[model samples]
Target chain A: MRSVLCYGYGNPGRQDDGLGVALVEQLETWAMAEKIPGLTFDSNYQLNAEDALAIAGHDLVIFADATGEGADAFAFRRLVPHATIAFSTHAMAPESVLALCAELYGKQPPTWLLTIRGSAWEPNGALPAAAQANLAAAVVFLKEWLRRPPAAV
Target chain B: MNPEAEKVFNAGAARANAAYAGQRRNVTINPITRLEGHGKIDIFLDGKGDVERAYLQVPELRGFEVFSLGRPAEDMPQITSRICGVCPTAHHMAATKALDSLYQVEPTSAGKKIRELVYNAFTLEDHALHVFVLGGPDFIVGPEAPPELRNIVGVIGKVGLEAGKKVISMRRRVREITSYFGGKVVHPVLGLPGGVSKALKAEDLPKFKELATAGVEFAEWTLGVFKSIVLGNPEYVKMITSDAYTHKTCYMGTVDANNNVNFYDGVTRVVDCNGKEVCKFTAKQYRDFIAEHTEPWSYMKFTFLKDRGWNGFAEGPESSIYSVGPLARLNAADGMATPKAQAAYEEFYNTLGGKPVHHTLANHWARVIEMIYAAERIEQLVNDPEITSPDVRRIPTALPTEGMGIVEAPRGTLFHHYQTDVNGLITMANMVVATGNNAARIAMSIDRAAKGLIKGGHVTEGLLNKVEMAFRAYDPCLGCATHTLPGHMPLRARIYNQSREIVQELVQD
Candidate 1:
């Protein structure tokens, strides 16, 4: 069985900041109904060091998050392990978790980061209309991508 | 929406959440600035550009009391734990203990052990994060480093990438252990009213034993790192022992039956600055001894000993100011129960001039020692013969009423109190979080450090870093209100109904 791990991270309470979480929730529904084998899903406010172990034994890992820096639509990019590790009281970057996988597990899976563009960050806020459109577009793309064969990686 | 809701929160996040809304992002709020949607640290300046007073305006999260009304009392362990992302386990354990009191049932021996095992694992994780993530930059990366360099990344750069890998890996191992027992590390769900739902099977004990053993070695290495970086350097030690970061307030924590520092359960012990025991009280008597003074500006109330009266934020015997957490636990106890931790504790006091060390920066040292104890305790727990016993819970059959539970959170002493109806429905729920307890000191620390560092309206990144370090030493955990809606309300009425009662509610400017 080819194991794939989809991990989404963001502060869902902040408007549009929950884009990553929203995406994963949609994927979970699709995966469950379709009975997509060898797929596991997890979500949190931010990626932490332990998530390295969470993804350690899996063959492929995809980290999903909402970004204030990217374009309004969405950007999906492959990620490589970095040699540095920096932590905080706030949150950890996706790349840092990937790096830990390499350092601690003596193995690194092929990984990608799906960054949904977020336009707002109000506390107890809702995802804005435009961001919701972006989320819908991204979800469509992700659904197609997941159905594709593993050779695409 | 509750009137208090309009006064503070938007509650949009709570509303947006549907089935499997996934993990919440709004749990880690600090003190909020009412209706403003964000917290601010206001520094009032005098004519000469000298600091008058600095107040960290912690906005109150409104309607939680009202939000939680009419819920089954048993749901509190799960609900209250959702308040913070960082220390959910602390809140969960406190609520569970309160449940025990409310139901008037004692957990089976195995059940209490399971809870402590998981609780100690979380303490280990929390302290490691603080030492390496929050406190590391100031000491490891150098105090005078640039703004960009004053972070865990910079600390890793100086401490060697190998150490970074070990730190990350070690933290993961401990968290995994916490999850194995508590069901999840960030927001645990295993805690129940009488006892835990799961037991430590003999088969899985080996994995936990391996990790707990690693935890001990990790502490030894971390102490060595601290010794070389902070204590070994005279300048660092001087700064740690400096007057600007010192507070001569009283200390409080829970101690075991032997009077050693016990994080899981103990009586509340309060000690003066001179290392003299002031008073020891049970969780029920917390009211007679402690009082919270609320300021219009902060959502959090400043806690002090009632006998001293609310003397404002001044730090002295006459003033009611007090501190908690690792330093407080150490000061309030006779010693640590574990041998290695006791040795470290004694060395810490001796190095800092013996008993009730006043230097706040030494909290980092005290915290490390506590982590050592937690790690050792985890090992001891894994070896217990009854650790695998199936009798993990004592089915509660007692009447419901009022109950209180206290625990030593990695940050400080955390208090959770609840009052329920005869049918076990909650009527009242109140918490004076570790951060709430330290609110006055947090403000005072900023004030004192600002007076020393920020001169004549001039402030550099380094100077501000120093001031930031003062709060960092406390390792303060603020209520992180990140959600658009109040998601903590598993069952809601007050945050909504209270707002309905308030026909005219205005957002404070």
Candidate 2:
């Protein structure tokens, strides 16, 4: 069985920014009910250097985050190890994480980014109706995507 | 859209632009990336193009205190931690300590030790991140190097792949110790009212002991790396002691009974520019010593010494403006509590020309010394017999009222204050984050660097980086300083001519 790691990061306290983690939560529940094998779930407020090691251990990884940019409700794209200078210690781009993994751990597992559209970012505000719709659509698409064989993915 | 209305709008915009073109030129470093949150530096230039006044603005603000109102006081530890992903543990520990003060209950000896152990481990890792990644490019990879050669990748190239791997491994192990207790390093759930939610198990002691030992070794090696790479280069040392980065402001930090630097708990100590003790106060008495001064130009409130008063951005013995963080902490305390760190402290002072080194760039060296202290402290705490004791909490019976808690975060001193009603619901909440405490001094640093570097309207990428180096040494976390979302923003610097027309633009991704 191929080991797959699903990592989502964003501040849940912020209204629409929580879409990434919210999707992971729903995905985890569905995956558990289906008794999916070799699939792991993790989350945090944002991505950091330590996450490189986490992705290195898996055969496949998916990084989920909410994006203020993009016209579509959700977009998924394959990731390559690309090193970019990070501005802050608080967070790092998904590509940078993959780059760090390749450099430090000598492993560049197949990776993908799932960006869901978000609008509001107010503190303590609930997810807006539009963001919820985007999240649901992303979740449905992800469930189908995850069911595919590792080689095909 | 009507054509006549469009014409009218265009004419109005032209008039406004023409008016702005006649005004004094301004140089703005917007969205200063690579640090937490969004920061912008605006340097207003005189007619000759020399800097007149510079302001550092934090545009994004979250209503954290307002959000805390009407919530249960017990929820603060969790809620406040969510404010910044970079320093969640600092907020968690501060809020936990505040809860102890609110309930008027002391944590069991074991619980206090556990908290200390976890805190030191966090400091070691966080400081490592800054030293190896965030601040590394400036010194480690050489400030004069090209932008592409001045990042973590560059540091790896200079230090070799093995060293890079070691840093990742060491940070992973150190954070493991934090996650073991807090349940998660990002948003820890360990702190309770009087104690921790869980106690350290005996079986886990061996692994912690091993990790602590490895952490100390790693820190010692890091100190050696700094000694060779940063301290060995005379140019780097000259830059560190340069006048543009020097400040004569007061310093503040927490210290133990022996006047040694402490991160977890101690009396707050304040020292003047000459390194003489100004005052010592408890967490509850912070208001008597420190006050926040507001300016209409920025969202951040500058913290100053209350007795001396707010005397603007001037730096001297009489100036109320003070700084916190590694260098300040070292200057405020007599020595480090641990032996190896104490020797390092002596070397740092001797090499830098005695107590209270005034150079801002010296903060990078001071931070490395702190790593030694944190690692040694972690080793001491984990080996104590009381570490494994299960008596971690005491029931609180006292009524909730007003309480305050303070901790030395990796960046600087952090304070959490709360007032609760009879039902234990929060009435008011306030926090004095490290970046806010250093805001005034940071503004002065930026202004001074801009004046020294940019002359005759010439702003080079290297020069602007030097200006940024002044504040980057502080490792200011604007995300934690203000309650804002932690997101990455590109760095852009725009210079407006005397007529307020765009003269030059520089952008970095």
Candidate 3:
């Protein structure tokens, strides 16, 4: 059985910043309804090095998170192993989690960083209309991708 | 919940929502912000740039008490497990034990062994994470290293990559053990009123045996790393024993009849600053000995010994401000329950000069030793003959009533109290979390360290980190400390176990 993971990271309390977390919520429902096996889903405020262990042993891992610096829709980048030890602390960058997987566990499978463009960041902000639309598009794309996670970006 | 506590939570949440702007008069470090629940360190300085006071404030807007009022008592372990990811096992176990008392039943011998095995494994995982990632930087990397280099990365840079790999491998193994026992990796769902929801099968014995043996080897390796990098260095040793990071606070923990530290179950022991036994109290009598005092400025309550009284955060034998966790556990007990930890405990006191060592930095060393014991205890529990027995639970047959449960959480003693109606619905709920127990000392340690390092009006990043080191040693869970309200983490109520009769499920939309 091929193992695949989908991790969404963001603070759900924040408005549009919760886009990634919302996607995770949607994916959780989809996973249960569809009864997907060897498919794992997780969500956290941010990624930690321990997340590397979480994503370990998976053939493919999709990292979804809110990105304010990205385009209106979303962008995907294939992640490669690199030294990100210096970029670790209270939270970690998604790339750093992959780097940790390679350095600490000896093998980091092919991974993708899916940056869902967020429109706002607020302590009590709700999901914005724009980010919601973008999330819908991203979800549609990932629904097909879950059937066959790409070999590369 | 009290109105005054509610008022405090509102006030704290308002203040915590502000930006992490370090004003000229103060500095903040190691603040957990945003969705993790806001916790910021504010160091108020005098006009001349001298330290006046330091406050570690955390926002408390979680309405757990109000929401859990009408819930079934049996589902508390599953419900409270979502409180924080840091110590879900601790909360689950505490809630499970509280159910045991409320239902007026005891777990069978196999159930007891299973609980102990899981708890020890959790201890091993939690302590390893703290010593290697959280508090490890200060000792593994040079304490005086730059702020950028003073983290787990620096520890990896100093200690070879193989050691780093072992650290991750060890933590992963223990987490797997917890997942196997608890029925889930992160949020476990296996606690029951009388016993656990599931039992360990014989097929999993070899896996656990491997995990326990490997955990022992990893713990020994961690100690060796501490010995070579921390104790082996004269400067680090001196700093650990130095007065800057030292406080003469009383100690408290749970101990067996032989006065040995026991994490699962025992009487609560309290000792003076001089290591003399003050009193030992049972779980039911915790209110008589321990009392929590509220400060209007903070949401979390400050706990102090009732006999000693609240002496305004004063540190001494005369004060009720006692410390907990590994240092306190070792100090309050005569010795460790395991051979390896016992030897380490002896060397720790011998080098530091006597019982109840006041040096707070030695908390890291004490934490590592406890990890050693936790690993060894796992080995023993796994080898127990009844570990796989089918006799694990007894159905409750008594009326629901008030009950109290206490256990040694990774940080310290965790207390849970609940009062239920005849129909087995919760009426009252209260808790004294381990981090909340260390509030007085966390404040004191941060204040004293800020005073010592922020002198001469030149506040550098190094100085701020030094202050943070003091609080990090306690391994304080600011999220849980201020977890009065789930302002950030929205909870959903689902059917935990629906085989029952008349269990209503309601949640905030």
- Model 3 achieves a DockQ score of 0.15
Docking class of 3: incorrect
> Compared to the true structure, candidate 1 yields what TM-score?
0.82
Give the clashing residue pairs of candidate 3, or none. Answer: A15-A125, B61-B485, B62-B484, B62-B485, B62-B486, B63-B485
The number of the candidate with the highest lDDT is: 2
Q: What value of lDDT does candidate 1 attain over all alpha carbons?
A: 0.74
TM-scores for candidates 1 onward, in order:
0.82, 0.93, 0.82
Docking class of 1: incorrect
Query: Candidate 1: misplaced stretches above 4 Å?
Result: A1-3, A10-38, A52-60, A65-88, A95-141, A149-153, B1-39, B185-187, B481-509
Over A1-153, each residue of candidate 2 has an lDDT whose tens digit, in order, gives 889999888777666766778888899999999998888998877776778889999999998888776799999999987777655445677887898888878899999999888877765568999999999999999998899844666
Candidate that beats the other on DockQ, 1 or 3, i.e. the better one: 1
Better of 2 and 3 by TM-score: 2
lDDT, residue A99, candidate 2: 85
* Model 3 agreement with the true structure over B235-332: per-residue lDDT tens digits: 98888887779988889999999999999988999998989999999888999999988764466788999987876666666878898999999999
What digit string (tens of lDDT, one per residue) describes model 2 on residues B374-470?
Answer: 9999999988999999998888899999889999999899999999999999999999998889998998898678778889888888987888788
Worst 10 residues of 1 chain B by lDDT: B489-498
Best-to-worst ranking by TM-score: 2, 3, 1
Candidate with top DockQ is 2
Identify the runs in model 3 with alpha carbons over 4 angstroms from their true place: A1-3, A8-48, A54-56, A64-93, A105-110, A113-139, A148-152, B1-38, B480-509
